[model samples]
Structures are given as structure tokens and as C-alpha cells.
Target chain A: MLSEEDRRKGAELLLQAERERKPIPQLSKTFPDIEIEDAYRIQDYWAQARIAAGARVAGHKIGLTSRAMQLASKMTEPDYGRILDDAFYNDGARIPASRFIKPRLEVELAFIMGEDLAGPGVRIYDVLRATEFVVPALEVIDYRTEVPRAITDTIADNAAFGSIVVGGRPVRPFDVDLRWVGATLSQNGIIEETGVSAGIMGHPAAGIAWLVNKLHVVGTGLEKGQIVLAGSFTRPVDITAGDIIQVDYGPLGAIGVSFI
Target chain B: MALDWKTLEAFAEHLENAELERRAITKITDDCPDLSWEEAYAIQDCIRARKVARGVRITGLKMGLTSLAKMTQMGVEDPIHGFITDYGMVPDGGEIAMDALIHPKVEAEVGFVLKRPLSGPGVDIDMVLAATDRIVPAVEVIDSRYRDFRFDLKSVIADNTSAARYVVGSSTTPFAASDLHRLNVVLEKNGSVVAEGVGATVLGHPAASVAMLANMLGRKGEGWEVPAEALILTGGITEAVPVARGDWIDVRYKDFGSVSLHFV
Candidate 1:
């Protein structure tokens, strides 16, 4: 177990590094004495600090859920972190890139809850019963760590959820075969990325089931009215300060954003 | 605070202690400029210790910047990952205040649940199916904590990728009947078609993404033993769009139903 002293010290160190724009060494080198569990302790402290600073906990983001992502990050497992209220955005609007250090965009599906979802024996049917609707969303991913972070380093940081865009077309959970849903991502009127909803774990909501089960193991559950980015279909698009990014979803409609 | 094996059995002990001391002193002391990486880890070590005390269980992890475009934008070749916690889940159709997040963003994605255990190093689509469970619809809300949400890959990873809000719709489909590669997804703003996409775009299929995840972790000797019930997110289907206040974004999965969100 991490002691209060250690938690505070770790947060201070990270805060200091961030303040001075310094880098933290990998746990393997800096503290051969540290363990995965210990690294999470620092993450907890970081979350606490955010909470203490008035950040309201929102939802959780799953990262490195794919093999390609793990290989790129040089890590082997998925990571997660908290979402706060101050970071949320809406549809048909301008998101000033100035609010982000280095912001990137991704197209994804969004889910609305109809009932309560708890962990520990939560079934797919339960998720369906609890869900009220589904829609297209754009996830803005921003990071807080250094460039080219090791898996362990990333774990210490949250999953890098910069902001989110939701509320487009509302599809009934049972009305359509999610696997058949498709999307095309364009930048400056040019297609850059494309894919279908099935790319996100067969059916998009399946990712949420994974998230719920994962959280249940930690004694958590999914509440109503929260937004979960089921996962991405295409590789993320490169977003520039003045780029007009658009994600087209055939029948469900389309969403666009301009970085300024 | 001696650093020895026996004394450091709980390594968190020394780290946490030192951190508290530093925290107390730093408030009064002049901010130390140019702290070393070793020093940063020292503090990280301490925070990890305290988390254990809080009983915050370690859930799964996530990778960021996996997309070629994201990597190029960040000026880095590799992606970054972070951890998810039990306290992060939110409900669909619920009200969310925007004041708590740093710079939040949202996206649409398909979620997968496993029916059996699957590991990496040699896992494939067949493996994903053999171990498949029910599938559902979902949406992810991302929010960064950095000032103006600015940071490099490493810094973002440390900040947990700004993960924030999320909602899963009440819809389930059998994996066998699910045609992931051909699936069509649409994002609507104010009831208008704004974005569209398909499933094949996510590394071929979302299940393939899972196979990759298993294999990646296998190399670390900690690959997922994916039980009969494990949820996995398969990356984004389209590019992320910007949002503002009082907007309603809906994501419709052609055959899987739809989910929506209202930002106030």
C-alpha cells in the first residue's frame, strides 16, 4: 500500500515536472523498487488532486485496448483514467485549439443510459436494458505526459481524453445492426480515415460492457446520463489549429468541428 | 527513509513519506526549478503508495495516438496508454456539467465483450469469435486535465489522456450475426447528418484490435486472460468533431440502434 507521504510526494514531483516541463524517468530505471500497483497509487493521487481542485468525475476512457496501440506505446495492456465535467463539449460548435496544448480528434459512437448498470455479473442484456439511446460522437484526445511515453508512464497519466462531442442522430439500440454502421473522416474536405461501428468490438456497445466489467472488478458501476466513447473506428485524424475536421456517417448524419 | 530491499518491501512506504515531506516543504519553499527525472519518479513512487491505501483497484488500460494521423500531429511515432478506474463510469441520459472537465471531447466506438479467455502472441479473429460474448453500443467522453489541455505524449499519458465521461446504450447483438467490417455509423448534430463511417476502418475489424491487445500484453508476460466477460474498446470509427453548449449529438449504428448526449 502506498503511504500518504508517498502519494503526496509523487504528485508533487509530477506537478513540479509538469510545471518546469521536465521529464520523469521510466519506473523500470528510476525505481526498480516500484511495482504496477505502486504506479497506480500515483495515479490515484493525481485523480484526488484533480477532484480536490473541483473537477467532477465523469466517466472512464479505455486506451491501448487494441494491439496496434499497445505496440505503438511499447506497452502490453489497456489503461484508463477519469473524465471531468470541465472538459466536455457539444455539437455544432467551435472548439478553440487554444484551450488544448496539442489536441487531436477521433470519431466514435455515443450511448445514453435508460437504466442503471452495476458491475459484478452485469450482462449484455443488462446494458441493453439500461441503455436508452445511441448516437455518433467525436472524441477530442489530448495528452498530459511527455512525448513518446512508456506504457507505465502513460498509465500514470489518464487515458488522455481531452474533450468529447456528442448528440447527433439517436439510433435505437435494437433498431439497427451496429456492426453495419459506417463512417468516413475528412480533414479540409478530404477523406483521411474511415471505418464501421463493428470495428469497435463487433458491436460498439460491447466496449461499454468491457468497461463496466472492468470497473465492477474495482467495485464500480455505470450510472445513467454519462457519455462513454465505445471506441474508435478509424485511426485518429491529424488536427491542426485551423483545420475543418468532419466525420460523415451515411444515414445517421454528420458532425464537424473547426480548430482555431 | 533508507532504500533497501527488506525495508522497501512496500516500496510505497519511503516514496509516500518522502512525497508528503516534499509537499509540505515545497508549499513554503521556493519552487524547485529543473527537477531531475529521478526526482519526478521518486514522487510518482510515493503517490502510487497512497493509491493502494485508497483501495482504488487497477482496471484495464488504454492506448492513445495509435492512429497514424494522431502520431504525426503529436510529432511522435508511438502511441501512449493510461489506466481506467471504477470511479470513472457515468450513466447515459444523465445530466453532465461542463465546469469539472479541463477540455473534454467525445467520440463514437463499438464495444466488445468476451465470453471466454483469449491471450496474445498468436490470437486471431477466430480466437476472438471462439471466445465471444454479447455485443452492445457505446459512446466515449474524453477530457484532458492539462492547462488548456496542452501537453506532449508523455505528459498526456501521465495525465490519464484526459479521460472523463462515457455512456453505454441498452442494446445487444449476437457476435455471429454481427458483420463488423460492413457496419455503417453516422454522427448527427441537431438532427442532421454530419459524419459517416464503416467498421473495416479500425485495423480491419474491432476484434482484430482485441487480438492485437492480447498479443501486446502477452509480450509483457501479463497478457489478458480475457474471461467470459471482458469489455474492450476498438478505437474510434471517425475523426473527432468539436462541440459546444446546448448541443445534442447522436450516434446511430445502422443495425445496432443509437445513443445520444445533450451538453448544457
Candidate 2:
């Protein structure tokens, strides 16, 4: 366990690292007694502070859901973090490169809720019943932790969510079989990647089920009209200034964007 | 969906120079505030415009909150999504530039090629199985943008899920009546086994993760599209260990061939 003072100092150290772009010695160096859970508490404390500072919580991001990612991070389970309103994007939009520290882009699915969802036992059907619409989206994830973060560091960094883009048409939750949805991702007129929706837990909605059920224990719930990013089907990619990104969802229409 | 560039610039500058204490960031968020969700989205659109203006390709999509434990740890109650660009995708057995990234992590995953189109509402796991044309092994490289890698959710989303590089390994036998959960996965750093795991770590099985993704998209009125080959990375099977330049990483699935990556 970490003392409250250690938690505060840890938060302070994180802020300093962000502001100065300087590295802080590992938490192990400072407290020598810090546990992964303690690190998370400090991170949560800092997150609450950001929220209190008016960072309107938008949704959450899950990481290490894949067995492979878990091994890399040296963790057995998955991790998550929050998203704010400022992180969202729409289709056929332009993103400025100057605004981000080291921005990158990812294609994903975004879920828009139609009704409130709380859990402990929120089944996949419940998620479907409450969902109003769904859109093909892109998630831009960024982090605010020391470089070379461990799983604990990533969890503390809120799963590194940065921005999101939703494009093409909105499909009804009951319109099609989402698990097998297909996509061919092209960049600058070339095929760079391809994927199916089922790659994400057989169906992306199961992530939401996991989210609600997990959050229920924390005394939280997903509200209506909130957009949730299920996770990535393809591996993530890097972006530089002046890059055009387009995703074709076939029947769902298409989404395009560029970075300047 | 445009940012007050000037304000954003000022905030960035403030973030750079401010003390980075809880008090300092709190003061800045209070004083500078963040853009509305709509406004932030506009910024994303603007980025797309910029990309078009330049000539980068738009690649596949990524899921943000796929892990149950992560959601519980972050104090956030829901999951989010993001975008990927063609410029970001790296080929299998390829090298990634170290200078181009602030920090990068790798995740092994399962890739699915679609035989047909799929959409949502009642998309089921069986449907996914029926639609899967092929299954392959893959690796995702994640990096973030915020200085010192610090950001709230919104700022990070605007940055796009810290996407960096990825490599798809060789495909293997399909899950057709097989146990994806029990399959063994060994992660090797420079030809040595650094980590070992199984598919069950990713919410029990990668298929289950895909199932969740389908249902989530269905709620959004969007079903996973047809002919959409997906690399459903079922999150990390083990912890996200760090790597440096000149490091060679390979993920060997018991059923799937090895997927490899190198850093330079």
C-alpha cells in the first residue's frame, strides 16, 4: 500500500513528467513499496482531479484484451481508462498535427448508447436493447505516463486514449450480424490493412458487456447517448502530418480524414 | 465536426511549461477547458482534411476498451474506439524507426479475414465463425502522443489510441471445433522465450472478445461490415513488456505460425 502522501507525490511526479518531458525515476525507486494497485490508485486520484477540472468523461478504453498484449505488458488481465469529449472526431474531418504531442490513429467501432446501462449482470442482449446506433469509428490513443510504461503504467495512463473518428453510416443495433463485419483499410489509395468485426471478442459488443459489469462494481454506469470504443480489430498504425486516412465499411458507407 | 487552434496551442504550451503538479494541471483544465465532444470531433475531421491535403491512407479501426480489468482499474465505466491510418501499418517481419515514436509497446493478436459482409443488432458468435474466411496471427504496436505520455481520455482519443506499428504473422488452422482458449502462445524476444500465455487470457477467448465487439457495434447501429477482414486483437495475453531498438520479438502460437517484429 502507498500512503496518501505518496499517491499525491506520485501524481505530482506524473504531472511534472508530462509538463517537462522529463523522466521520473521508476515508482520502485521512490517508494520502494509501491504495488501495482497502489500505482492505479494514484492514477485514479489524478484522473479524478482532471475530471474535477472539467474534463467531461466521455467513455472508456480497454487494453490488453488480447492474450498477446497481456504477455507484452506482463499482466494477466486486461486494463482500461477514460475518454473525454475532446477526444472524439467525425467522418471526413481534418485533424491538425500541431495539437497533439505524438498523435497516431486506429480504426475501430464506436457504440452509441440509447439507454442507461449499469451492470453486474448486463448481458449482451441488454447492450443491444439499449443501443440506439453504431458507427464505424477510428480511435486515436495517446498516453500521459513515463515512457516505457509497464502494464501498471499503462493502466495508470488510462489505456492511452487520445482521439476518435466515427464515419460512414449509422447502422441499427439489430440490422446485421456485427461479428462478421468486414473492412478493407486503405491509406493514400493503397490497401494497408484489412479486418472483420468479429476479430474483437467474436463481437465488439461483448467489450461493452465487460465494461458495464466491471464498472458496476465501481459504482458507475454507462449513460445514454454515450459512445464507447470496443477495441481495435487491426494492429494500430502511425501517422505523420499530411496523411489521409480512409476506412471503407462497404454497406456502412465510408469515412475519410487527414492530418495537417 | 474545428478546434480553437489558438486556445489548443496555448494549452499545449501551458502543459509544457506548467509545473505538472496536480494543482497546475487542474488550474490549466479549469482555465483552458477542453473542447466539447462535437468540437473535439471537428478537430478529428480537420485532421482527416489535413491528411487528404497531404496524401496518407486511412487504414482499419481499433477498439479502445476491450479488457474488463482495465475498465475496472481506470475508474472509467465504458469502452471507447479510435482510427488507424495506412501510414501507421507496418508489414510483418519489418523494422520500425525508433525516433519516430515516443514510446511503443507490442501486442499479439488473432486476425480474421471475412468471407462475406456482416452488420449488427443481433450479430452472434456463430455468425462470426461462419463468416471467417481465414485466421492469422498479428502484432499491434501502440504509442501515445501526450508529452511524458500524460493525458486524460479525451486528449488521448484525439491522439488516436497511441497507434504505431503492426505486423501480421502466418495464419494457422481455424477455430473450427478447436479450442482457441487452450492454445499456447509463447512470446520470444530475440529468439528466447520471454513470455508464455494462452488465448483464454483475452476475456476467456479471442472469439469472445470478437463477440463483444459485434454486440457493441450493433448498439451503435453499426454492425461489423462484410468482407471486412478484422485483426481482432483480443487484448494482450500477457503483460505489455517494453522493448528497445535492435530487439526482435516473435509470437508463436501453438496452432498458428510465428509472427515477428524488429525495432531499429
lDDT for each candidate structure: 0.62, 0.65
Q: Over the stretch A23-61, how does candidate 1's per-residue lDDT look in tens digits? A: 554433444445556666676787788789888877666
lDDT of 1: 0.62
Kindly provide the TM-score of model 2 when superposed on the true structure, using C-alpha atoms. 0.49
Candidate 2 local lDDT, B10-105, one digit each (tens): 544443233122122332223436555444333444555555567876555555545554555577654555545677777778888876765677
Label model 2 with its docking quality class: incorrect
The A-chain TM-scores of all the candidates are 0.85, 0.87
lDDT of 1 by residue, B234-257 (tens): 666655545667778788776577
Most accurate candidate by DockQ = 1
